[model samples]
Target chain A: MKIKKNIAISQSGFAFDPNSGDSFSLNPIATEIVNLLKDDKDEQFITSHILEKYEIDEFTFQRNFDDFVQMLKHYQFVE
Target chain B: MLPTYNIAITGLNNTDNPGPGVPVIRGLREAKSFKVNIIGLAYENLEPGIYLDGICDKVYQIPYPSAGSTAFIDRIKYIHEKENLDFIIPNFDAELFTFITSQDILSDLGIKTFLPTLEQFEERQKVNLPEYGKKYNVQVPNSKALTSLSEINDLRKEFDYPLLVKGKFYDAYLAYNPEQVINHFNKISAKWGLPVIVQAFAKGTEVNVIALGDGNGNTIGAVPMRKQYITDKGKAWGGITLGDEKLLELTRNIIKQTKWRGGMELEMIKTNTGEYFLIEINPRIPAWVYLANGAGQNLPEAMVNLGLGKEVIPYTSYEIGKMFVRYSQDLIVDLSIFEKLSMNGEL
Candidate 1:
């Protein structure tokens, strides 16, 4: 899945979709993931980065990451 | 130097179900091209806007529309004599008929008003929605106007169980069965008089567009909003501007077809399948008009310019994603101000 290019996520985790005019607030981890996605980072890289910085195991990170990605899709933040 | 105009406005009742007066005034106060000295025309002594600081330079109590055109015009003339009013904006639906019909008299008195023509106003009434839809080639849910109790039995032939029982001027209730329809019919007719309208319930998300039309078939401004929080009265407590091109295009088309003058709010239902059904068209500015100003289209200011016979260029863009959340606050007022307005009809 690819995040839409026009979605602007501020450093404070305020996400705005210019096309739909919908706004969202993301938690820090979600914000980091979105920033990584914005920089064209692959899901594997994002997962490793999250796995490295946090206490969670790889399996739990993968499950949570999948759920987060699903949420982004539901909000039409990703294509 | 920006010109300063003396403008009078009505509908100052800023309650739960707000009149557009306060927000419209807020927009006019923020106008960049011109300055305004606001004269508030109120029907009651205690309208919140009358007490609000810096909203109106002077507040004059005017006769309600129930008092005929003669009394209405007489009061307006009295106020105009004092204020030398350049323009008047009547914001209530009940009062619009009086103002629209008396446009010539107001103009003769050097008081300009930008309002829809009587024909435009009458044709878009809730009772005439079906015909308005047909004439304008817009999608409208099936509806029938009933003048008696017996008509409720016949509703099943056309509409489903869940339908809307609506009053002529205001109020709408969703009735789930024949008994509920009869109940609402009596309640609404008792309040707003005959020919209650029963409309098929269009299942969808309710979206609204606040728009302004210049008399010459041009849309000066149009902004679509989706209600984020809805009050029990069906008014939006919070709404966010949307970038829905289809909705904006529909608004523009309606304005072009009707050559609608003045400010209007289009209430519509956008279904999941992407079809839009025109529901109600309010012929005056809505209470949430400040959202348009916040989104970069100062419709009220544009409307004031249009009222002065100025050539206003249509607004081409507005920042999307702007949101308006309504809040209430208490204002301390001296009893003498209220007493003066009550006794002398001016404050």
Candidate 2:
């Protein structure tokens, strides 16, 4: 799933969505997820990318991603 | 005219070290003007370890026979009279037993002891988060403390899988499904006890705030931060976080109600609900005491000073976005295991 809108991330990891007005600080991993979402990566591609990068196990990574997506939806930044 | 006061830290022998003893020793040594003594069951020879290093003026070991008996009070009394000690600080959970058991009798020994009553201790050790969260206006998960395995079966109708089974003051295991939750619950409870807190797993960033409180519940000092990395044992091996005044205020409210004097760690999770959920209360110094000191509030030192009736130094705000990496003898072991698990890239 894509972010479907313009997203700006500062060097310090502060993220701003022009459509949502929900300014927040993202940890490094969260920032990477935002970048992928902006790039329109599918769930499979995102999972593979996260698997290659973080030390988390697949089961945990999947759970975390699902949670992260839920968070994004809660923040009204994703559909 | 140095303010000569003798002090002691009990339970300096807990396995979690450079345990609380190391910091207590260091604080006493740094406060060189005060006459301090080290006392403990000597789990690691910490008392003399610090004394020989000149951290304290005297180091005394409580005899084994005296421990957990009436003779124990005699031991502390002997030291109190001989040294004119101002206060006795219980360092570990086990030490609290002695002080609480003989609190009234020890009060006559002319040395002040800092501890909550037995009931207070048990109440504080509870895994009930929802009750505390709502009572204090701190957001927490929709959760319940389960006392029996049967309770989970009853709770299954309301809560979903991937439930968080948590030890009140220690560790947590995330079970992805009800079956897994039950399995982990039975195995862990056999080793520990319940009611284990069963809650909807919060898939969000977890952050913690560590602070010192006066027995009346006012905050003495605070350090708020987010965990960077966690070990399988549920210890934060490395973390990067910033301090927040709002978080500190909420903590202050909790302590006031509890009259929780001493060191405390409050865990909060920022959830998809767009709110921060207060999770648990640990009434002890966290493993990251050094990090809090780095953040400009030396909590151990402040606690020591408070015990002596000294004016505490004001705390300054810590840098935002600052990070800390914790290195320990145990972390080395976790790294070896993490290395093997690294092949799969998930733990």
Candidate 3:
């Protein structure tokens, strides 16, 4: 549930994992989530932030967030 | 003023399983210290580098290593007399033995070459992987060489199912059973000669390191890469430079212990448990060597400097996260160019 400290995300939503040398292009939502995670924000804070900023309901945000986090885990971006 | 050296290189076949020649030339062309007149020493007339404009100033069809050193060196002598060559870089694996043995004769002719010594060359061969691993303190899979089919039945005792059947110089197949092993053995042996290697299968992700050793136990340059895309021939179609310190440390250790000279590619597999096993050590610059250049370490340039007996400071760093994706394009050429190379042996 914790993002690796060395992950570098650019303004263009390009994410680079310096440790594994893997690069990824994140969408706006994913980029925001990663930025929030970098700032030590908890999942509850991220959920509320997304719900308040976007038109999506709480349940949809939670589901998408879970899926996104799973992908981050699969790519070894998060520990 | 930068001195221009006449350098000859081989293995210009830029096919699916590409050779290091084209990329190496690209590095040399971009060299900061000197300019070059590239001589293309090709075994076949149609090798892509021979046809590529501006890559080779002149191209000559040379005899294969199978022709033995006398004929090989004689052709080189002929080329040297005409070109006044300063250095030669032979890129193919099958030709390394001839080059290593002829190092002294080439040196006597004032043609400098940075190559591993014959002992260094022989000890890191695929057939000697086990001993090489032990001597160099690296982890290598248990492997046995089979000269005949009679040895196949006994392989099961030492290795489990889905082991690797490998040729001496090239090609490898995963054999699930004895029948497949025999098939691969016959196929590989027919192509690459006797003593096909049977190695225990190590399941993991394949990673590679392109390294240059200074023959004095110093690593001139090293860059680790992971294959982002693999062709059916098991060649890296695309790869990226990595920031993995462990792989770099391992490369430095091997270069230090072996006092390995010249360009080498270390093919390794990183198991899920985070252990790295040395799979194969290719004794020349890899086809993807341009990646090293793009990542900030121009190893081919360093190699030329070393060949010329110039002092070269070891490259301290390369930009990680740099990726190289390969592509193919058709080149339009006239019939006369091919005719000239085929008929006159030089163009």
Best by TM-score: 3
Interface RMSD of 2: 9.3
The order by descending DockQ is 3, 1, 2
> Where does candidate 1 stray beyond 4 Å?
A4-6, A17-22, A32-62
Candidate 2 residue-wise lDDT, B20-139, digit = tens:
655555555555345455543343333323333444455555644325656677667776666676777666654555666676776676666556656556555546556666665667
Pick the lDDT winner: 3
Q: Please provide, for model 1 over B133-235, each residue's C-alpha lDDT reduced to its tens digit, 9 standing for 90 to 100.
A: 9999999999899999998898899999799999988889999999999999999999889989999999987889999999878999999998888889888
Query: TM-score for all predictions?
Result: 0.91, 0.66, 0.95
Enumerate residue pairs that collide in model 2.
Answer: A56-B346, A57-B346, A57-B347, B139-B277, B146-B195, B162-B176, B228-B239
Best by DockQ: 3
What DockQ values do the models have?
A: 0.49, 0.04, 0.70
The TM-score ranking, best first, is: 3, 1, 2
Please give the lDDT score at residue B108 for candidate 3.
Answer: 98
- In candidate 3, which residue pairs get closer than 3 Å at backbone N, Cα or C atoms, i.e. clash? none
RMSD in Å for all candidates: 2.4, 11.9, 1.7
